[model samples]
Target chain A: MSTRLDFFIDRMVSQRACLDFGIAQTADMQGPVFELGLGNGRTYHHMQHNIKGRDLYVFERAVASHPDSTPPEELTILGDVRETLPAALTRFGATASLIHADLGGHNRAKNDAFAQLISPLVEPLLAVGGLMVSSDRMYFEALTEMPLPPEAVEGRCFIYRRDS
Target chain B: MSTRLDFFIDRMVSQRACLDFGIAQTADMQGPVFELGLGNGRTYHHMQHNIKGRDLYVFERAVASHPDSTPPEELTILGDVRETLPAALTRFGATASLIHADLGGHNRAKNDAFAQLISPLVEPLLAVGGLMVSSDRMYFEALTEMPLPPEAVEGRCFIYRRDS
Candidate 1:
């Protein structure tokens, strides 16, 4: 029970950080909202509702979310994010203002490895001063750690800004 | 000690809620950020750095916060918030997109009454779809409760959106 509560809190805090990034910073930056995970589509839907008028381009392996939650055709990137993200940059241009990386799994080792794998690929696409809001901390050259807001518990939500 | 911890968690959850509101909704809206309290300038500083290029207007009884953290002369509204908020809005115009109400004293009854006192004066100034991120749950007719993001412990933070 306690573990479940912790999971809920962690996701809640991290997701809030994502929203704050959009309002506080992404509002000024030009580009569509991007996400690496479309699981359940909860986060994607939340972003759409909160950031009205922003386009969301997502990379997913399959149509995992409820049909109602899926992004429209042309917005969804089918296949593994590791390969699709680079292809996406070529198509969309490196203009993502906000990127929410929600890639994590029940296995910690795998999740950690996956984050490392994609960090390099994702780095170049973020526009200057764009935000990378993630579930886990991913280090990339030129990205600076933005302080977590007061409501965020340490280690729960990781936020970084591309300063350059 | 436990009481202090609870207070911290509550504030943290609410602050996360505030950020969620901004990202999810306020980023698309127009207007400057407004604050009802300026204690220590911690929250103010957090907002400025995270939100990026947004002007912050603050109301305080006296000058407080670190010298470096203070908002500029034009942005800081001195004297009581109930008075300062209205006059400042007259100058700044009724276009505040994000309003952070942090008025909290140890006394619950006084805080409740103070919330009531300030609600009417603050409401009209919020642009439609602007956010009212407060320490307490202030019920206004036009405001709707945005679901608290996952990390937020229920009742710890209160968030309301100006739907109209």
Candidate 2:
């Protein structure tokens, strides 16, 4: 595995506090969840373990090297979030109730592109009171530049609630 | 503010990615850094700001409210982790090259009593030839369990090279 990939995995394993925090925040919300930048399907598995019977769509930039080896039934892997997010949305025929993305630290251009792609889909994908929880690092950067208040950019995860 | 304190402050504001990934892991090494439990100070500051300095220590218990006026510089407040941590460490003559504690989720007994209070004093905090870098959620949790395989952890933050 690449160093970046290994680092990401190690982080997920060691930092259970943050992961559990994010999971708890969105546990009670409804689902038909979408995970962007699904690295090695770990977070996807975490969500499965926590919230069962929820449909899951995971978008990754690359196809898993071992597809069909251990396919998760609930997870549908879409290659290249930039290219596949819109198509996956269309296939699902609905906007995601919870869109979890962690692509914000290193790749500025890719992160920005993903943010823009998902921004327009937020309202439509979320159900009434549905949420879009994204990593603070990626979303906060986009949020700070926009004219939002400080309260708007605090947590590592951002929750977008749909009213209607 | 002292330059060391200033360095931490700048980290909290500008380099959150580094703070969350890089500095947080330092506490996890089998040295002086260990996880602390949930408390009031963590809610408002430590976790949010990612502040770490020699003079910093967080209380494992909650305080109902903040004092009407700040205490003298020499006197350490128990509840205000942001202020008290630095004070306590300095007063105790304790020093840490790295400190990592995520006092936000799942306050367990062991983490508070054993890990937090004692871990900070481990000599030669970083493992020889160990590197400090940011990581993802999965790997972060994996480190908690003992007997970590040699291959699982890599990356160098600040190399610990002793003069030959």
Candidate 3:
């Protein structure tokens, strides 16, 4: 495993790589951006600028980001991801072209379990050829690993392209 | 300097980081994405997908990329960048929001000189709060070094945020 700083950087770098690769795969794709976790909203804000032209819907238990990073009320889907995610399918439907799943923290065991629970609900919303950039390794039947952008450690920042 | 694979990865990772940070800095600014060197067109293609809703004007010496990576004719500004770039000001007129400069090669000294020569003309087109992601150590009077994203070898992937 990498150091704490490396972990932090890996998440960012891998996510960026996924977005870049996702763009390559789906240049014509026009769909909303989905956020599995809106942690500090720093990544969310970063995603907004880097990956422009997509409506962003965020899932969070509570609004904990710095006031500046706070997303608008409409874009925020509150409540625990385990609960809010199901509701996302009904609202957004299968329309997400890019998903940044930054869930799971230091607790490897708990996060693995949580990732299992959340992934199914989230997977349905991603369009075919959509990109899922996640911190924890989650396997969806329809998703396959895409090449990682340089500096991304294998297994650390997992990137999958939804194919089915 | 990193190995060839590392260098390739560094270029993409740093570019992604810069675009991500640049987006955070300027959410409302609307301008075209600029490219100082359109090597292979992979990064430009990635930018197209990762950063949507922006016009991309690429400066390239010749049609060099794989056919699939090619940009449309309207977006391609072909010629010596230094000569063509000045012409760009007449057409684009200081309206670039993000600049991806992937110039320089085995000849570090020559590339440094080229970067310096090009920086002045290119820098003016970038908006006050735009972003410039480059490969060398070229510094613009109005631009400042944005923090290097994690794992970005210092001096390899230079990210500059333009602050008027």
TM-score of chain B only, all predictions?
0.88, 0.25, 0.87
In model 3, which runs have C-alpha deviations exceeding 4 angstroms?
A: B1-164
Model 1, A77: alpha-carbon shift in Å?
A: 0.8
- Evaluated on CA atoms against the true complex, candidate 2 attains a DockQ of 0.02
Give, for candidate 2 chain A, the lowest lDDT window spanning 10 residues: A140-149
For model 3, residues A42-130, the per-residue Cα lDDT tens digits are 56766665565678788888788756567899888888877787887897788788887888776789989988887787788888778
Ranking by lDDT: 1, 3, 2
Tell me the lDDT of candidate 3.
0.73
DockQ of each: 0.01, 0.02, 0.02
Residue pairs of candidate 1 with colliding backbone atoms: A12-B150, A12-B151, A13-B151, A19-B23, A23-B23, A24-B51, A50-B24, A151-B12
Which of 1 and 2 is the better model by TM-score? Answer: 1
Instruction: Identify the superior model by lDDT, candidate 1 or candidate 2.
Output: 1
Off by over 4 Å in 2: A1-31, A64-74, A108-110, A136-155, B1-164
Q: In TM-score terms, which candidate is top? A: 1
Backbone clash total, candidate 3: 1
- Compare the candidates by lDDT and give the number of the best one: 1
lDDT of 1 by residue, B42-151 (tens): 66666665564567788889877765468888888889877887787787776888888888865677887888888878877788778788777675767777777776
